[model samples]
Target: MGKTIAIANQKGGVGKTTTAINLAASFAVLEYKTLLIDADPQANSTTGLGFDLRNIQQSIYDCMINEGQAADVVLGTEMEYLKLLPSHIDLVGAELELINHPNRENVLKKIIAPVKDQYDFIIVDCSPSLGLITVNALTAADSVIIPVQCEFFALEGLGKLLNTIKIVQSHLNTDLEIEGILMTMYDGRLRLSNQVVNEVRQHFEDMVFNVLIHRNTRLGEAPSFGKPAILYDPDSNGSVNYLNLAREILQKNDATKITNQEKILAASDEQRDT
Candidate 1:
């Protein structure tokens, strides 16, 4: 089965959508069959990928609220290996609509079930909130990637987000894990940025990703052109950082797979001996 990762942060302007777009694009560039699900009502992921909101006929809103199938709504992106389940502004009201539904937390999980095995990675770009929609995304995801801005206010509300994750683990998805905390928009010239990075790393240690996404002009401009940094300017620091991040994630998962396989083999050997 493909791994489902949610790019989540309750705090806005933290580069959550930027990380989601670039990271998913990086995975695609690396030849992984990837699906980027725009779970945020803003539809930034949809537009950032070169999609026009006016042109969308059906979207993730339809899938969640109208029982629309993912296959019908999924759009092929400029990258051959990447696909997108676009979101609509209508999703703003999804939380209220789903409130009374039975097992509403699992709606997104069910929506993507049929298409899960078709890709190597499915990345959900969650809304910047701890509302029901984010809860649904968390419940559906196998893991989450938290993006923290490299600024003075970076650590603020982190505790609340962590608490929300713990609650989801206890009551919704026990298999859900935090992939890592991604540090974004770092400026080496700024002592404040350096300080924030140091403090977050000190607190989270191994849980923080090693690659820091630096502030790049191309990275910001690419969105306006409806393209990822890699497609817009492959040589830019923004593109390079995201590519490195993708490779790091791949290496980590590969190590986990090897460890799991070794455990299975060890178990089999014990069984044979017994």
Candidate 2:
């Protein structure tokens, strides 16, 4: 089965979508079959991967509202191992439309079920809100990546988001785990940025990712040009940071797999002795 990770942060302008696009692209570049799902109505991920919204025949909205098939709506990207389930402005109204539906929180989960196992990783780009859509994304995901911006108000709304995650864990997805807290937009030259990073690390400790995504001009410009930083400029700092981030995640997951296997073997040995 594929691991589904939602890139979520209730705070806006915190590099949430940037991480979603580039991280997914980096995974694909590393030859992992990856699927980027644009759950946000903004469709930034769709366009960031060189898709034109105006030309999109079907989107994630269709899958959620009209029960469209994910495999049919999925589009191939420039990268061979990467695919995209595009989004549209129509998704803005899906929250209201699904309000009274039976088991509404599980809708996204069902939509992706038919196609989930086909990829090595599924990355979802969630909107900057704790609304129903975000809830749905969280419910569907096996884990979430919270992107925290390195700035003065870095920890402002973090508590609320964590509280929400707790509620989801309690009531919805019990298997859900926090993938990691990613620190973004760091500027080492700014003392305030350094302080923010230190404070967050002090509080979150091992939960935060080691990679610090610096403020790179190429990263910002790539979206406008309809390409990820890696494809746009592989040598750029932004590209390097994201690639490192991807590698770190892979290593962590590999370690987790080994640990799980050891536990299983231990259980089997105990059973045999008994």
Candidate 3:
């Protein structure tokens, strides 16, 4: 089965949507069959990937509310290996609508379960809230990638997010893990930025990604043009950082698979010798 990762942060302006769009695009460029799901009502991920919200006929809201199949709402993006489950503004009402529904937490999980095996990676862009929609995304994902801004108030509200993850792990998804903590909008020249980075590294240690996403004008401009930074300006710092992040993720997963296989082989050899 494919791995489902949620790009989540309950804080706005943290580069969550940017990471989701560019990272998913980077995975596609690397030849992985990837699917990007826009779970945020803002629909930024949908538009960032070059889809016009006004023209969307079917979206994730339909699948979540009207009993529509997730596959039916999947749309082809410009990238060959990248697909998108577009979101609509109507998703804002999902939280209230699902209040009385049974198993609302797992609704998104059930909707995407049927197509989970079809892609190498599925990326969910969560809204900036710890509401039911975000809970559903967490319940559906195998792991979460948090994009934190390198600012003075960066660590603010982090405890709540960690607590939410712990709650989901204990009740909703036992296998859920924190993929990595990404530091975005970094400026090496600024002392405050450097201090924030050092503080985060000191706290999270190896959980923080080594590749920092530097503040770049092109990164900010790419979404407005409806394209990923890599596609918009391949040589930009934003594109380079995201590409490095993708490489790190792939290497980490590959190492894990190798370790698991080695353990299995060692077990088999021990049984034979006995």
What lDDT would each prediction earn against the true structure? 0.93, 0.92, 0.92
Runs in model 1 lying further than 4 Å from the true structure? 255-274
Which candidate number has the best lDDT?
1
Worst 10 residues of 2 by lDDT: 255-264
The residue-by-residue lDDT of candidate 2 on 1-274, one tens digit each, is 8899999999999999999999999888877889999999999999998898999999999999999999999999999889999999999999999999999999999998899889989999999999999999999999999999988789889999999999999999999999999999999999998999899999999999999999999999999999999999988999989987987898889833333433554477589899
Question: Once model 1 is optimally superposed onto the true structure by TM-score, how far is the C-alpha of residue 167 displaced, in angstroms?
Answer: 0.4
Q: Tell me which of candidates 1 and 2 scores higher on lDDT.
A: 1
Q: Model 1 over residues 123-149: C-alpha lDDT tens digits?
A: 999999999999999999999999999
Per-residue lDDT tens digits of candidate 3, residues 1-274?
Answer: 8899999899999999999999998788777789999999999999998888999999999999998998889999888889999999999999999999989999999999999999989999999999999999999999999999999899888889999999999999999999999999999999999999999999999999999999999999999999999999988999978977987898888823333433554477589899
lDDT of 1 at 27: 82
Return the TM-score for each candidate structure.
0.92, 0.92, 0.92
How many clashing residue pairs are found in candidate 3?
0
Q: What does candidate 2 score on TM?
A: 0.92
What residue runs in model 2 are displaced by over 4 Å at the alpha carbon? 255-274
Q: Residue 161 of model 1: what lDDT? A: 93
RMSD in angstroms, candidate 1?
Answer: 8.3
